[model samples]
Target: MLVQDAKNLVIERGGVLNCLGPKLGARFDYDADLRPLFPLIKGNLANAQLYDRPERVQFLLDGILCTIYAQEVVAAPFLERDQVLRFIHRLTATLNDLYTRRHSLGRNHRKTTMLPVYDIYRLLPGTNCTACGQPSCLAFAAALSRGRSYPDRCPGFRQPIAHHAVYPVYDQNGNLVSTLEMELAADADELNRQAQPTREHPAVALLTAREEEVLRLLAKGASNPEIAVALAISPHTVKTHVGHLFDKLGVNDRTQAAVWAHTHHYL
Candidate 1:
């Protein structure tokens, strides 16, 4: 199992939730090395959001916010301790399932962005459609931008698919500060407006299917021989793949390649 247990579950500032009627934010520390699963979750789950640097992953499910890190998991707005415990149990099972099926899932390491409220507003039907339970399209747009609502809420909304666009934010030293990610509408006008953001990062060269498999295994600390055996390939072929990975990733050795995979959330 990827995550055997979640320990130290506790409510944080339980009283602040009084107005919200006993809603609780619970956190628990764990021992799982979930870095390798980040890419799998991000690429496979349509609703999940991922970030690097400190490595945080989050998704909204059933109106609950579940945030995961390398060593801990947090879920919020539960009614009681039992609810939190049940959530933790379900989350642990889900993580374990994701890890078990990691080999079959696709991987994506692209940066994510937060869309502006107005941009989100443009994607809606703009009919002042209160069918989504919101008074106005602008109000619904605000909820969508804040991750408090989803695009499917609007019945007249034609395109509900998420389109990811990355815009790198840099500081004066040209060091990357953050990457802005947004779900774009299919409209051409939306794309034109989105093009205004500065994109400093060059397009990343994607890895082939076999190369991705090899990299994932390598990141999991598998030796070359183990990778060869797992992939049913010759040792010489595995060595060649490793060499290619080193060259493509601009890394010197296997350890460096593994580090790169982790940093980029490829693992």
Candidate 2:
């Protein structure tokens, strides 16, 4: 599969740009009918929204909207785009290939229900307490929904408040002033809209197809003989493949090689 056609690398409006860094937009090319990419993508991304009928998977990468369509892929920060592309390629290798990692996306691979302020207001204690510096709980809910304030600011929520988090709210000094940062789904997006590019990941590009297969098998705790049997190859060939993977991953042992694969998102 010719996974993607990277049309052009655009440097976003405001910042120092890296070689592979604001965004890469591409018309994805693949036999879409055979692969379960939407489910796989919805499974891998941490923040994702999926539409079942239209077949769209939307997610946020470093605060950028990574909208994936049946025929296209758009993501910001060169490294992120590269990562998504590689992930797609790895998954598309076989119909059964699926990503096994931290997935935080759709609730049911369905459309996102609009969450209005009224719905949030109903969840509040309705105490009308000024303990959070707000005039009332409704006002606090409003602010909380916008992510302008956090739930911990309210003394009423000493216990958990269903789905809300008491994340750290950093001050201008980059010091933790309070653990009162609440993310109400949509409002928890990154504070900085102008995303900065991440460091390059050149390790993935160094591995060959056979090495990748060997790495995947190693990640599954397979031995050389197991891998040989799985790939329909001899144990000696499997050893050679494993050696090449180790050299590329800069790891001496199979365990280290597996760790490298996982850390690099290759597995």
Candidate 3:
């Protein structure tokens, strides 16, 4: 593996990230020189930004912000201890993959800037889908430009992708900044409905908002009582919601419900 150990794990608390959904971030210090892998990362990730001066690459993965410096890696929105381990594993695997294939990949040194917020907003589904936890598409776009958000956070970018097509954007310096995958020729009304928070998944329309919340908690391995406490509801109500969720999702048990939630991205 390119990065085997993180010498230290630093957490940022009550910091700037509180406004961005999480109150903490994770910083991993490593001994590997990540400079050579920047080109491979830039070519792979949609929002990768490589800087030559400091030798770093910043990108988004699974809605989490990641930055790879020459000898360190930082991931944010505060992952749990287990989540941090998984993140490190994935990070190591990604870096190792890039290192192993570096010979076949072309190297690039061009510096690219982030696309304008308006430009990103224009590419969004324009549904004001708050599923990304942002209030609006414009707000999400601004967050994305600042590397605080990712495009896939938009439900419009997540589900029912009937077709795929690349939409390229160039920086002010005429350099290709992003080649985002945009849904093409999709039914507008369906996309809008799916983008709605209460109906993020195609099957979610069959479940109530409370049931959806319960299902998500269950998928996280929360017990009925735990879910009740988390949702500020009674245990009986939580059970009822779980039952309704199972029925609506066509599942027989909690395990099946959890599997369904995961299969439909409710988790």
Candidate 4:
């Protein structure tokens, strides 16, 4: 029933819904047909299809795997089949509500307004420091898509001479929508200051004192194997802790986390 509902919903939204063969590896292709409706929608449903598998739902719920893709919810590698169905039911309801509201507003709410980083890189310090908690230049670009952060928090982009620039609009399906005027620097700065630090761990506030010590050791050049020996835990256990640390830190790489720890005096 869940699968059928999902298929129907996808079609109702004008999305192409095809069941992938096993050899395709749980892949689906939500093409440009749904572009205008969900501007953030990107290419191929490769990651989104992972939710169809029963064993990966826990990862989805924990945000360990894909969370939301193309506006569809996905799970990770250990979710049960029944759980996936339930998720679909909940998702469908939420989407229905959203669609109703959007209809009333006479606009597609899934469309996201974005600013390209290249046009504004000149206003940014271009340090790629991850001080804002993102790893690379492109990662920052992606974040800007959400309008959560601004170019000036970069410290380098705070120069007075930098000109403001606007990015082209896109739908959730990664389809081009329209171009918007560049955001004023004044507005951008206000938004940046209001941006909260990305939650590293959803289950806790920052790291615990013990976790901080472990992270400090990691920043100071301790390998997972070495950390395990120092903390008197098995290497596998160290790996688990490290995984948690990465999520808590919202870091994609250990080096970035290390840099953050050093810059913020976590080390």
Candidate 5:
């Protein structure tokens, strides 16, 4: 991966980027004989993996986890390809850092031994905030990998750790057009607190007041013909409201619709 090495690695890939997309996705081909750098990959990326496919690997590039294929890759979008390109540049820079360095790496540097801690620190925020009850972020990462530390100590990682979440979506202007939220992990006994169900749920906001009255009556076992009489509306108008209710509630039958009302306390 020398600066002048044309054969280092240049992938052919394509992908899309939406203003409000979940992730930056791309598909690209790697050389058939991909390097066996699992340890190095893990040290540099928050997420990295080597699978049964000997010639392929997946790793985080910027915010994207991109797959480098040995034999096949799928076309995606423009922004995704750009991220992959930047990833290639970073990989090259890493090679430059590795090659010209004079430091003594542990002899043989086999996977049987732990990953180098300094490398582990590379992926961290580098804040050295001591927020994880460790002297430094590096110590925290090592403790985490070794199972000596739980994920909750890092307020930053707690929610994602609990849910195995994807990062939030971003738009082309780098705006947060959509949000993915994760709640902090609660104590083991938090589930024991009993909570009362409340009526007039948020879904009611989607319907007009008149429509909500119709749903309440429907949930109370009123026939469509009966509802028309009580609401002082024609049967045809009642049927129209029922259809509207079904569309908004996403229910196919009277029973399912009634169940929704009961679950949300609309009844």
Candidate 6:
């Protein structure tokens, strides 16, 4: 099966993709054949938001498959042709990073069933004491909901409700995804970690809005001409913006710019 082949390739390349339980979070399982031939649900979700072109998505999937196949075929120990494989791997990583970033920023994936902090606090004993460190239980609960505070900070909730509170995530069909079996606090901790604020690079602020949009496309592994076509701009304009981004970010090449942008949340 193509999915099996993809799995094998990943394993052969010293990578592991495991199906984590609901407590950990929903895992993205790719069917190797389906990945190239069919559109991913996440890609569909992104298309709905105009974050990616369908053709580009297909191309990225195809490139990923090709890279995997190349890795499987070039199983030699010698350095016969290292540069080509390294370039492919870098491109694959950039495409994957862009897909993840688009999914993360999509409004459709936002927590829809999050319980209001006030409601959770109302269930608590209405003590205005600073035991929780925010002057009131409501403040503490709000911070917890925002991922700015942990449940353990609330002295009252630590023992009683910490084990029952649940975070929400939607499956591909818009249904609630079942979390893996785990204690509630453990699940909450995992959720909180995922919700931490991303850090943006200082150089990102130097980009014009148009340049930023182009950069996002580039980070998604779009070629300069492809980006120009998507944005209805000339290829020359795309190259100009690319050059500006490289200068501002102090990078010498597209791959490095992409890596820095992804690492700093600029993409």
- Going through the candidates in the order shown, the clash numbers are 5, 0, 0, 27, 7, 4
Report the C-alpha displacement of residue 169, candidate 6, in angstroms.
42
Candidate 6 residues 74-169, lDDT tens each? 121112234334544554454455455544543332221223454455444567675654545654554444344555555555244124554333
Score residue 30 of candidate 5 by CA lDDT: 35
- Quote the lDDT for 213 in model 5: 76
Candidate 1 structure quality by residue, lDDT tens digits, 120-227: 555566898577656567656554553444565577654432355454444557675554454534565644443332121011222445676888899889999999
Q: What does the lDDT read for residue 232 in candidate 1? A: 86
C-alpha TM-scores of all predictions: 0.44, 0.31, 0.40, 0.38, 0.28, 0.27
Model 2, 128-169: lDDT tens per residue? 867765556655555454344555566665444234564443
lDDT of 6 at 155: 57
Least lDDT summed over 10 consecutive residues: which range in candidate 6? 18-27
Better of 3 and 5 by TM-score: 3
Stretches of candidate 4 exceeding 4 Å from the true structure: 1-66, 69-92, 99-162, 165-185, 188-192, 195-214, 247-249, 260-267
Top candidate, metric TM-score: 1
* Global fold similarity of model 1 (TM-score): 0.44
Ranking by TM-score: 1, 3, 4, 2, 5, 6
Q: On a 0 to 100 scale, what is the lDDT of residue 161 in model 5?
A: 22
How would you order the candidates by lDDT, starting with the best? 3, 1, 2, 5, 4, 6
Give per-model CA RMSD.
20.5, 19.8, 15.5, 13.3, 21.1, 17.2
- Model 3 lDDT, full chain set: 0.63
> Local error of candidate 6 at 118, Å?
49
- Using lDDT as the measure, name the better of candidate 1 and candidate 5: 1
Which stretch of 10 consecutive residues in model 1 shows the poorest summed lDDT? 197-206
